[model samples]
Target: MVDSLAKMVGSLQKDVDKSSRYAFQSDYALFIDQLFYASSASHITYTSLLATKLGIDLSLNRLVCLLYIKDREGMPLADSRLLYALIRTIRTRMTNKNQDIVGLLGTSRIVYCPYAETDFFSREKLENQLQALAATLANTYPVIVSVSVGLYAQHVLEYGQSLRSIPAVVQQNTSNKSGSIIFAEDHLVDYLLQIIPKSVLDHFLGYAVHYLQENPVVYETLQALVCNDMDIYSTATQLQVHRNTVIFRINQIKEVLSLNPLHQDSDRFKVILIYTYARTHLNKEI
Candidate 1:
């Protein structure tokens, strides 16, 4: 009887130890996911192996979107339940449910895609998805959420750096425009872009930029036009407006800036470059 009781006790201890180990591994895996959000390594061998051990695949190209949630007055959601629900909603809505990986980074939720060129999560589709998701979140959660999506990259490692660029990009790109889906700066070349003189920027496109700031409709049209290679139809389609509306806005922008993005000359360069910088810069005005 004594021997049997000792054996039973040992078995219970072993089970407890096993459970603890499993829990530790789970926590470690989560930590690694967050770490790689800011990762700069060529490829994280340890993280890859860790992911494999946990049945995750980090071999494919990667993209990350960081969602920062706040109250209507711009305060963090201090309630734990809200944070969990926010993460779950974003993950369920943005990810493939069974495929894409989602993790928590501090108070933010990180949606990571190891599958590049996916139908729902691909570079082309993500912005639309995020914009829709942001609307959904605003309606459902009653909180103001800002989204930073970063996929423009060369190597998988640059993705981590891309994630790190969210804050500065948010500050510069949208002027803290709540509920905006911002694209993260993908390269270090932005450091130089940031140094472009505010005076020079104003000299060329300042009136145009400020005019766009006050007129969201024309501004977005200009935005879509420039991004879509100055295609009126594409800008119209993207904005869900009439082609003539896009054309009218394009003309408005031309009138405001006295330069045309449609032109293939130095005027074109000034409008495109300066408007981009102005639209994305922290201050709307010099």
Candidate 2:
């Protein structure tokens, strides 16, 4: 009788331990989510203090890998496998043992926040890693997920812009690429296009297409310029041409378009709007 009672007590204790082990920290997750939305100085400061108290290291670099589980038809999906993989992924990559805050937002949103060393991340590496992960997930799991590894934020405060911009990125870039996650950072032109009216894009796309067909190199140069953030040196390197040649092309584009994108901010925005629309939407093959 004594042995049986001891065994029963051990079994109950094991069950209790297992339950607590898997329990979701709703309050912690919610607090982290709200901190991303925090903007004002006072509020941000308060959140930072709260974060410190909770053992969240405010010093490390933070980046979120978004697993927007969706079907091939561009529909969001609900699958337990997504959560399963997400948890494992975070656990594997989590740098801080005390700071793993995974946000389980709406049905479709399962976020993993990983804090790493300050000198650890770069944009190109993050994108490549996400792409590899997406492929691996598709092959490893039965559920269909459109994985577009998102750009990581250097600070938690920067999460607001990234999170807000993702929906538009997914909507605009998902039509042609199924089983691939489209990101706002990757299709930044698409993100820019969404804010502008369809009528404006329509008006400018024609001019962009005209130039794309006339001198494909010109469009190519412009695309390189935009991609390189209008640096003549970088654009020249990308095109493998002289910086003078890049400058000449910029002048040529300016003379023809009647706008100078290199110098003026407004002109840069307009030309960017035109460049992205033509490259992404019109299918002109520039």
Candidate 3:
């Protein structure tokens, strides 16, 4: 049954690709719908395999279990042969560790050809299938398995690479840390692009905006400090302000931003990053 199902899925995928080539823009929606249906059907066969292996016949309706393998260096693993290798590796790891395969039914990763240069499906639909698969796996496996779904979409790959470029501090602090892949919304990318010119904008924009709203004077002081070398006296002199005034502004900035310029290297680095991002990206008139 599993072999038959796999062959069926393989044939459906080829048909989807072929149909995608002649599909009009108006028919794109239907094409995507068909792709989702095919993927869902394929998932069902895998679920059955899991059920048979576990010796339990559970009426699982949907596919919702998802696992993500961290792909560093942007190694493109979209081909079915490579994907099968990865899946085999995962299975072997679980088996060697004495983990139950039946527990992995709904929690398995589905490897799909990348969306680039392919006409039969949309990446969004594939992701939706993954979410569905994850849900199903949760019920069947009775244990949460992080299913890593790989899409052979260039945009997905590009976005993943860009998100990876975001500093580790940001990733560690964000909500999407557990999953190896960083799924970003369109607005999130826009936000990053908007702030890209300014180095470290991600680090300090929130604090800077908040503090600047409360104390506008700190804006000028921050500008001077960032624009000049790391010489406090030189920055003070350049601003044509008393050194103490510069010190006072720096202290106020530290207090407001919850940053300590004296002892905390991380905090200092954050401030510098924010200032750089602001100066470079925002181009705000200081």
Candidate 4:
């Protein structure tokens, strides 16, 4: 069964590349999932083979993302095993043609593209380049892509380590009401939330969850405030409400959660943590 499944996956991997240039095949996801769940013995071997064939690191993060990519489709992630496979092909084609930086694909969809200081002068320029890449991808696949930029490092592995905050960031970036492109440099505080353990993060945010069930408006306001860097004006502009109304909503969040993110830096981290936790668990955009 394992050998048969492996052969099928290998053949499908080839077909994935070919189909990506035209229109993505959606049927392969079920086949891959079947291969994935056929046997515990086969899972590691098949995952490794897929990783090796696609030139991706078999990191735990990648494994988890591969599992979740099925659900993230059209939700800023688009989906499928072929998603990562297609991303790998894109990276290789770009490198072979010398059109872009060689990116690192940590999972089925997230491609960490490293750029130099000379790549673009401003964030807008870098974003334009990334959007063009997204356009290329959307041409073949029917999904919008989100990008997190301004990541830097001296080595490739170190760059991967820096992406610890990315899972949370991507969720937020894709959830953003304004745009799909997220500049990590701009949202440094939310990145710090990654330092907290998941259990602790969840526990800390549990208050907000409870409060949100009764008052989802407060939760929505909190997301707007944090995603907008706690700027009242911007939050109001985005939420399409009066600045005073935004402040009142924020005050309500502070009162209920007993966390004044606007008044203290530490408290701000807690708020970001709660927001990240909620975003991941609640599947609701903040």
RMSD for each of the candidates: 11.7, 11.8, 16.1, 10.5
Top candidate when judged by lDDT against the true structure: 2
What TM-score does candidate 2 reach? 0.54
lDDT of 4: 0.54
lDDT scores of the candidates, listed in order = 0.61, 0.65, 0.44, 0.54
**Ranking of candidates on TM-score, top first:** 2, 1, 4, 3
What does candidate 2's lDDT look like per residue over 18-84, in tens digits?
Answer: 4332345444554554555665564455556557668777656666556665555556667666765
**Cα error of candidate 1 at position 93, Å:** 1.9
- The sequence of per-residue lDDT tens digits that candidate 1 reaches over residues 38-142 is 232322443444455566555555566777777887776676678777767767674555445566566545354435544334555767777777788788986
Clashes (backbone N, CA, C under 3 Å), per candidate, total 0, 0, 26, 1
TM-score for each candidate, following the candidate numbering: 0.52, 0.54, 0.31, 0.45
Model 1 residue runs over 4 Å out of place are: 1-43, 108-114, 118-124, 152-156, 173-178, 185-286
Q: What TM-score does candidate 1 reach?
A: 0.52
Ranking by lDDT: 2, 1, 4, 3
Instruction: Give the lDDT of residue 151 in candidate 3.
Output: 22
